[model samples]
Target chain A: MSKYYSKEVMDRFMSPKYFGEMKDADAVGLVGNPRCGDEMEVYIKVREGKVESASFRTLGCAAAIATSDVVCEMITGKSLEEAVSITEKEMVDKLKDLPHVKVHCASLALEGVKEAVKKYEGK
Target chain B: MKKIYLDHAATTPVKESVIEEMQPFFSERFGNPSSVHRFGQEAVMAIDKARKKVAHFLGAKEREVGFTSSATEANNLSVLGAAGGGHVVTSSIEHSAVLNPCKMSSGSVTQVPVSSEGVLRVEDVLKEIRSDTTLVSVMYVNNEIGTVQPIAEIGKAIGEINKKRKKKILFHTDAVQAANYLSCDVSELSVDLLTLSGHKIYGPKGVGALYIREGVTVSPVMYGASHERGLHPGTENVPAIVGMGKAVEEIDFRKGEEVKRLRDKVIDEITSSISGVTLNGSREKRIPNNVNLAFEGVEGESLLISLDSEGIAVSTGSACASHSLSPSHVLLAIGLSDRMAHGSLRISLGNETTEEEVDHLISKLPPIIKRLREISGR
Candidate 1:
């Protein structure tokens, strides 16, 4: 029903994929917005120059939460460099659409993941 | 799963009786209340009846209540009109409707902070009052945390505080959230002006009233026609006013026993059923309908979306300001980290909500938290 995400994304949000974290993450990034009260912590497990696993703990709106779940699915098998390049537009496209109000939440999740990957690279 | 509505604190659906009562005003009694003909007389009679109904509801004299576009407008008028370039004192947690307007006006407000549990400190309010304080505007109930301010105590304080000062400081309350759950009588609350809205009480939107104590003068916010005694000026939305009155005319608040039973069931379920959770509002003093809880590991926004997928409709607080990137000011004021603020979910119950729906929510929420937490691996 929302314009920002697809039924597929909403379905993933409801019955999310790639949930749970690696027992030992190579690196973790915690980012928060003190103003709006939204926060996300992402964990990355790198192996053989690829992102073998991805997990997130998010304190945000539904869009941010569901988007994180979707991001995990999208990044799990990609190279660290590739995963870091993920965009909110890509997530929004995957969702088919999101409302204007929810777009920021999607962007936050993408940024949170990228920041986590950057943490892994010491950037 | 079938959907259930619980967020009545945000806004409620228009009742059928109110809808029926409003029909004639739109079609038949469409004349402006200011006209001087039979058509105008009919419209005038209707508005008078609606005004008297609103006044009677508040147990004030018939001429005291002035109709406005919404409770927000009434609050603006009361806060602005009463303080003519003089000082104002109000709560830090007032609905942005009151707080923002108060901030923009010529007068300044003290904005006394509430306790973490959201109780207004009576002493802090007293401390804020001074010789230059021309008006004291406090809300009867808080919208975000569902904390009820001691308006009666504040009223007593204002009464005593004003007796010593020569300015005759007026006392006003944004009583929009309190009308359904609390008493409507202004005398019992001991205030000079009170603001109320219809949509919050199952009436149509865009119609509200300000109960100004007789002989308590205030400058008009909108200037034009003599409608609403020049205090408010506009071609009245006759239908919405009728609907508002009808909504008040019928009082069907869910009972204390029922409210407690359902409130406790949901609180027990959310607190016990789900992990990584913390209730944001003060449980002891909160409105029975509101349940704002924070999940530590998972973001409230993400949880909100996941739950939405299960056909649930809830919110973090007021639906109006939910979209902003910043966390809730009220949450921040209570000492929550950005993490705690983002993880909050506000579940407000309604008349139609049943035990089964609550059980369904209880069943659905834990898995989402568990799944989200796992994804984070923290």
Candidate 2:
């Protein structure tokens, strides 16, 4: 176990939730860095201006995958406004804390959610 | 659930025999070798026997083997000692131990690049050789991708130059990764200095040897005691040296052929069956234990973590650079795009690895890649 990582990170990495894509999704969010070798795609199903279901797919480190799971759990069943407003801080705070090096994962997760919501709104 | 370790190129577990050999040195034979008493003389004898074992393994004169804390120290000493105020030449794919020392040398440094497959061209190295170049250091086998450099061919080229030059240029090789799997006879490799680490070959850590050809002069890196014949000055690590000696003495080059079979099976199964998979390095010229692959659409680090969770231990790159999120230099040098480089995995087999362990890895890896790619939706 790396001293750099927290127990929460390891737990989340070990059994990430809400992983994989959703069928008949209303919107899809994709974000990645070719250089960093991290790519994340988030799928959403919206009902009555609220997030009905959420799921994500990602190719990255443990932190990136964990962040994706965390973001999906945070936004599902929430109003689109609330889901889009979810900050990187709010997601990380929910994870207890992310490592300093893995903070980018939170941002990427946020981008994934925001992109999904934006595509759903047709804006 | 049994954990499978496939990271031997990083560091290997100490063998039971090596531990047994090292036992007496730490307890009953605990003596500062500098003392003139019987106890000290006994300690001295142990180190001498260890040195002779290492020397015989490398086909070197017994006196030419000098012990150091690790291969990194040996590399530093060789580059700094021999390249005294003169230019040094090295490769881009060398371990940081060799690369950094050459970088800090008093003389100018030139790094010859390797081919996209991570093979260093002899002609490319020859072109970088300057009249004032005092040393040329290259690794015998690359750590990340396991590309075996043409050391003998490079040595012949350097030898030709040495014969014609007034200041004969010296050649050094960081053979830390090569000692277990390759022919390391210094005369055959034709290197003036070679660095080897004990931990890489199932011996105790913090013990390594630098095989310096007789009559080759390298300035001392440290000052204090006259130990290691003034080249590396420090008190001897008696127990670790004994362990290292035992490790070298027991090494069987033939066993590596079995390792190669298992290594190839993993490579063939993974690359052929898995999507977005590509083998890294020149497969034909690689060391027997090495299998480095890049998975397209999946990040290497994530795959590494997933495999770890599945009771399989491996690496995305060199253990030294694992903490850094940046792509490996060796991968980039081999013409892998930032994406491909970032998605690389290195699985090195050891003597203890079995066909069952490899079959488990192959069965586990495809699903991991599939899941990560599915998550990515790309």
Candidate 3:
């Protein structure tokens, strides 16, 4: 195991949850920088004002993938407004702790979710 | 749990015989080689023997080899010590050991680009050579993709140029990755200097050797009591030096051929059986032990972790750069998109690597790629 990666990060990376695409998703959001080598897409299935389900597709390092999965799990079952408010810190906190270099992954995840919400609202 | 290590390019486990040979130096023969007493003389004898053994292995004179802490140190000395204030030329895909030192040269440095397959063009390097270009450093085998450059040809070109001018141009090859599988004959390569590492060749870490051809002068990078002919000044690391010598002597070229067979099988199987998989470097020009592959829609680090969970060790890129999330500069230089470069994995084979281990990794990797892809929703 790498000294830089936390156990939770490893666990999340090893068996990521909320992975895959939602075919009937109300909206899909993709966010990544080509130089960073990390691209994340968030798909949301919204029913009423609450998120019925959430899933993600990500191409990146361990932290980026884990944070993408974590963001999907965190925002599920929350109201649209509440889901949009999901902080990047929440993703890192859920992962126990992210290395300083991997902090950008959390922001990418947050951006992905917000982009998905925006797509759902027809923005 | 069965453990399968495929990260040989990163570092290798020390061989048992090497450990046995090095045992005495750490304990019973613990004395500084510079000391005048009998105990110190024993240490000195061991160092001399090691130097001679390494020199013999490289077809070099015993006095040509200088011991250093690591391959990085050897590279620093070769680049900075030899041409501290002169223009340097190097390929885009050299290991940091060579690239960093060249970048730090007091004079301007020219980075020649490689082909899409990661092989450096000798013509490109020759074209970049200017009158003031003091040194040309290139890696015999690339650390990231295992592409083998034409070192001997480049060395010949430099030699021809040196003969034409009053001021001779030096050629240095970072052969750290090649020491295990390729020839290091300084004469055959026609290089003025060569760098090698111990850990990469089943010897202990923190010990390496640099071959400076007879009459070639490289300024001292550090100041201390005269040691390593004053090129590198410090107490000799007797144990590591002895282990490195033994490791070099123990290499069996036939075993390297076997490793090539397994490496090709793995590469053929993965590239043929898996979807969206591409080989990174030139198939015929690559080192015998390297298999660098890219899986579409899969994050490299996630794939590495997934493989680790299955007791299979691999790397997304160079082990030295694994801590960074950025894509490898080598991969980028070879014209891979950021996505393809990020999704690449380097699986290096060693002499001891068995067919079963290769088969195990072959059987295991496709599913991991599948899982990551499925999760990725790509």
| Candidate 3 wrong stretches, greater than 4 Å | A1-7
DockQ of all models, two decimals each:
0.51, 0.57, 0.65
Q: Candidate 2 lDDT, tens digit per residue, B41-91?
A: 998999999999999998999999999998999999988888896988899
lDDT per residue for candidate 1 within B1-378, as digits (tens), equals 666676788898998998998888886778877789988888878878888888888999878988899998898888778787688898878888888878888876788888888778889888987778888888887787777789998888788877777778898999887787778688888899999999988899999999999878888877897778787788888888888888887755555447657878988888887666777768887766777887776666667667776777787757776767677777777777776776677887776678888888888888888877765454
What's the lDDT for all of these models?
A: 0.78, 0.89, 0.89
Segments of candidate 2 deviating more than 4 angstroms = A1-16, A20-30, A42-54, A77-89, A111-122
| iRMS values for every prediction | 3.3, 2.3, 2.1
Candidate 1 on A1-123: residue-level lDDT in tens? 433456766666656565554469888767756465556777788888788888876655556667777787788889988887888889888877778777777777778778878888884
| Top TM-score hit | 3
* Cα RMSD, each candidate: 2.8, 2.5, 1.7
- Compose the digit string of candidate 3's lDDT tens values, residues B311-362: 8898988988977767899999999988889889999998889999999999
Candidate 1 off by > 4 Å: A1-5, A23-59, A69-88, A105-123, B252-256
lDDT of 3 by residue, A1-123 (tens): 655688888877778878887899999998997678788889999999899999988877788888988888888999999998978777788888998988989999989988999998984
Ranking by lDDT: 3, 2, 1
- Top candidate, metric DockQ: 3
